[model samples]
Target: MTAACLMSTYQPLALSFNKGLGTRLWDQDGREYLDAVAGVAVTNVGHSHPKIVAAISEQAGLLLHTSNLYSIDWQRQLAQKLTRLAGMDRAFFNNSGAEANETALKIARLHGWKKGIEQPLVVVMENAFHGRTLGTLSASDGPAVRLGFNKLPGDFVKVPFGDLNALEHVRKAHGSRIVAVLMEPIQGESGVQLAPSGYLKAVRDLCKRWGWLLMLDEIQTGIGRTGQWFAFQHEGIVPDVMTLAKGLGNGIPIGACLARGKAADLFTPGSHGSTFGGNPLACRVACTVLEIIEEQHLRENAREQGERLLTRLRMELADDPNVLAIRGQGLMIGIELKQPIRDLTMIAAREHGLLINVTRGQTIRLLPPLTIDEREVEMIVRGITRILKTA
Candidate 1:
C-alpha cells in the first residue's frame, strides 16, 4: 500500500486513481478529475473503455502469452492490420515503444551493414524523444535523459527539428555512413513541436536521394492521437520504417516496428525477436483497440474535438502575455509558457481537479483520449485556460 518498495524512478503525484472511464478519473476517495494526459498518450480510446475491457478479459481468458518460437494467430492478424494501416510490408512486435525503436535501430544498422558501411549512423532530431532505453536514448536528443548515461553509442547524428538545412548538412557530411533517419513526426516530450509544413515530405525525398531509411517514431503521434491513424498520413507520405506503441493496445504493453521496401527485408530469422512481444492477449487487445477506433469513428472525433479545443484555448489564452504559443495537431496539443512552472501538473490536479502533464519545462501537453466529446473538449479548454491565466 506504500511506495517503500518501488524504485525511485518517478516523483509521482500524491494522488491515486481507483477508476476511470472516458475522459474522467476518480481518485481513491472518489474525487473526480478530467484526464487530459491519457496515461501520457497511451489510453487513446479512453480509460476502461467497455470494448477494451471486454477484449482484455476475453483474450486473457482464451490465452495470455506464448513465446515467439511458436506462431501466434492474433499476433499475425495484428501485424497484418497494423502494416496495412501504416502502409508498411512487415511488422516486428515488442513490449514497449523503446523496444520497438530498438528494433528500428537494429534494422538501420543492418541495412547499413548490408551496404558495406563499417559503422552506420542514424540521424536524430534535436529535442526529439524516442524512448528511455540505451539505444533509443542515444537516438533521442534530450539532455536530461541522456545525462549520467555515460558513453552511449555514438552512431547517431543530431539535427535541429524542422530545419531542412541541418538535415542537408548531415547528408553532405555523413553521406554514406548514415543508414537511417529516426524522428518523431511531432516532438512529444519536448512539447508537441510539429515539423514545418512539407518538412516530412522533404525529409522523405532526402532519404530517397541519400539511400537512407526514413524511420518515424510514431509512439506518441500514432494510433489516432493526431486525428489520422498515423501522423505521417497528414502529409501524404509514408515512412520507410515506423515504430508504434502507446495507444496500440489501449494500456496493454505492446509495441510494433513496421518496415517496407529494403528495410522490411533487413530483419531475418535471427536478427531480432521478443518473447512476450506479440502474445495472444496483447495482439488481440490491440486489434480490438483498432477496431473500436474505426467502429466508433474516433479518428473523426479527435479531429473535430481537437480543432474545437485548440480554437477555444487560443481564444481564451491569446491575451495572456505569459502564453508564448498555442499549437497542436488533432488531440496532441501543447501550450508553451514564457517561463517554466515545474509544479503545473500538481497545481492542475490539486486546484482544478484535472490530470495534465508539463513537458520541456514550460509546455503544458495535452493528449486527451481520441473519444473526447464536445462537452469534454470545452471542459479541457476551460480548465487549461484557467490554469494558465491564474498561474
Candidate 2:
C-alpha cells in the first residue's frame, strides 16, 4: 500500500495487527502484545469491546448516515447522558478532537463578538496539545507542529502551565480583549505534565472574577481513563466549555464540545454545524460505550489498577537515577527518564511484546485499557524493569 493512500503519515510503527481484545494485540506474525498506549488514548473501552462492536454492527446494518438535518434519537440520548456526566447544559457533536476544539474556539469567538471585543484572545497553557486542525494547531504549543503553516491564528496569549501568576498577568494586560482560557487538565503531550494542587480551583476563581470562559480540552483525559468521567472532577472545577473525543466511543471517532451557562447559549441555530456529527451509528456506539464503562465499574478499576501499577513501578525502579519520575492519575501514567529514551518505545515493543509510547523525548506515556487485569499490570512492569535496567 502507498503512504498517500493511508492517513497515517510516516508514522514510525508500521503495525500490521490483525486482532485485539481487551489489552492484547496480535499482529500478522502471530505475536501478542500487551497494548499499553491504547491507540493513543482512543481505545478506552478496549479494542473490539463486544458491546461497542455489537452496537456498531447493529447500527450499521440499520442506518449509516442521515445528515444532521433529521432528528436522531440516539444522538439526543447520548447528549443527555454526556450532559449529565459532564454537568453541562448542551453538547455539539463533531468528528474528532480537532473538530470539537474548533467548535469550542468558535464558541469563544462568538462570545467575544457578542461582548463587542474587536480582537478576542484566548489564554492557552504551555505544553498543551489540542489537536491538529488549523485553528487547534495555532492554539497548540509546539513550534514543530506548527512549522511552515503560514499566518496561523493569532490573538492567543500563552502562559506557563500551573502558573496562576502568569495567568493573572495576562488578565491584567488583556482582560478586556480575552474571551476564554483553554487548557488540558493534565498536559498529556508534554510528558503528562500535571498542574499544581489547587491550580484548577484557582483558574475557576479567576475566570469567574474576570468574567472569562474556562474551557478544558479533555480529549485525552475524559471517559473512564482517568478514574473519573472527567479529570476536572478531581479538581472540583467545572468549565464553561469542555471538549471531549478520543475515548468517547472507544475509537468510533466522536468529538463533543459541551457548553454551560452563558456559553451554552452562544451557538444559535444555523450558526455552526456538521454533516455526520451526531449520526445514529456513532451516537449508538458512544451510548453503549458509556453504559459499559458504568456497568463494569471501569472508573474504579482504572483507579485501583493504576495505583497498583504505579506503586509497583516506583518500588521496583526506585534505585535507578535514570527514572526521574512516575506521575499520572488513574490509567494515564508517564514515566519520565533523565534523558531522551525514544528508542525505548521501539525496544519495548520489539523485544518484550509490549506496546508503549514515548513523548517529549524523555517521557514514556501509558494509556492502558481500563479493563487491564492485575496479571497484565505485572507483565507490563516486568518488561519495563528489564528494559530500563539493561538500556
Candidate 3:
C-alpha cells in the first residue's frame, strides 16, 4: 500500500505491521504472520506479555534513571537474580549486547595487564557474533559484519568453532598470553550452529587447565531460548564470565556481564561502569521478564515446542534433497540448504505469512519466542517446508 520510509541500514520488508501476541504478528493490512524471529531473539516472553507491559508501565511512572551514583533497588534486585540464575557471583549491566561484550573485553584486558602480559589475547571462534562495538567487532569473526573495517584489534586468536582439538592445540601454544576464551553456546548470527556433544564441557575444562576465563556470549540464546535459562546450562557447565542481552529485558535495552570467582573481582568501581546500565526502569522490566518466564513455564514450552518443530521439519523435509541439515536446540534452530537461500527470507514473509531469517547466507534460523505453542510450531514448520520445496 505504501513505500518503506525507514533508513537503509535495516531492510524491513514492505509489509507494515502493528500488533503482536504470543507467536503471531499482524500487519497493517490485517495479515497475520507466524513469527519465528522474535525481534532477533529479544522478545523471549513474547510481544506485549502482560507482566512485562505491566512492569514497564509501572516502572515508567516510578523512578526511571538516576545514574549509577545512588542505590537503585531494582537494579540490585535484577543483578542478584541474574547472578543467581547464572551461578555467577557478580553482575554489571549495560544497554546492549555490544556493551555487555565490551565490558567482557575490558575484563580480559584488565586480567591480562594484572599478570604483566602486554598484549593480552582472547581466544575467539570462527563464525562467532559478539556485537558491533569496536572491541566486540574485533571478537566477532563473521565476514560480512567485519568487512570494510580494517585494522581490527589484533589480540583475538581465531579458532574453528566446535573444534576441541584445535582449541587444545591453540591453548598449548598461546596459554601464557591468552586471557579469556570467548564464545557463543550457539553461533546465532552465523546460523544457529550448535557446538558438538560435550563440546562446552571440553572447552570449560580447557579454560580451567589454562587458567583462562571462559566467557559465553549468550545474547541470542539466553533467557530460556534454549530450553534453559542459559544455553550452557544444557551441558551443566559454567563460564567464568558471560555476556547477556537480547531477551534479558524483553525489549527494554539492557545487557549484562556476569562474572564468578576471581573473574568477579576483576572489575573495580572506576575500572568499568555504564551510564544507563542497571537503570531503574530497565532493571525493573528485566526482573519482570525473568519472573514471567518462570511463572509461565516458558522453558518447558520452548523444549516441547522446539522438539516438535525440529521433528516436523526433519520428517517433512526429509525427502527434499535441497535441505542439507537441521541442527540446534530448543527455539534456536537452523535449517541449512545446499545453496545460499538469503532470498528465501523475503519469500517466506511475502508468500507464506511467516517471518524467518537467513543467516550465514545458506541457513535459515528460527528463533521463535519461548512462549510459542504446539500449533504455532506446526505452522512455522509447515510454512518453511513449503518455501523450501518450492524454492
lDDT (C-alpha, whole model) for all candidates: 0.91, 0.91, 0.89
Residue-wise C-alpha lDDT for candidate 3, range 59-82, written one tens digit per residue = 789878999988999989998999
Number of the top TM-score candidate? 1
Residue pairs in collision within model 3: none
- Model 2 per-residue lDDT tens digits across residues 202-308: 99999999889999999999998889999999988789999999899788889999999989999888999999898898899999989999999999999999999
Clashes of each: 0, 0, 0
Off by over 4 Å in 3: 1-7
Cα RMSD of predicted structure 1: 1.2
User: Cα lDDT of model 3 overall?
Assistant: 0.89
Q: Superposing every Cα of model 2 onto the true structure, what RMSD results? A: 1.4
Model 1 spans with C-alpha error above 4 angstroms: none
Worst 10 residues of 3 by lDDT: 1-10
Worst 10 residues of 2 by lDDT: 1-10
Residue 380 deviation, candidate 2, in Å?
1.0
TM-score of 1: 0.98
Clashing pairs in 2: none
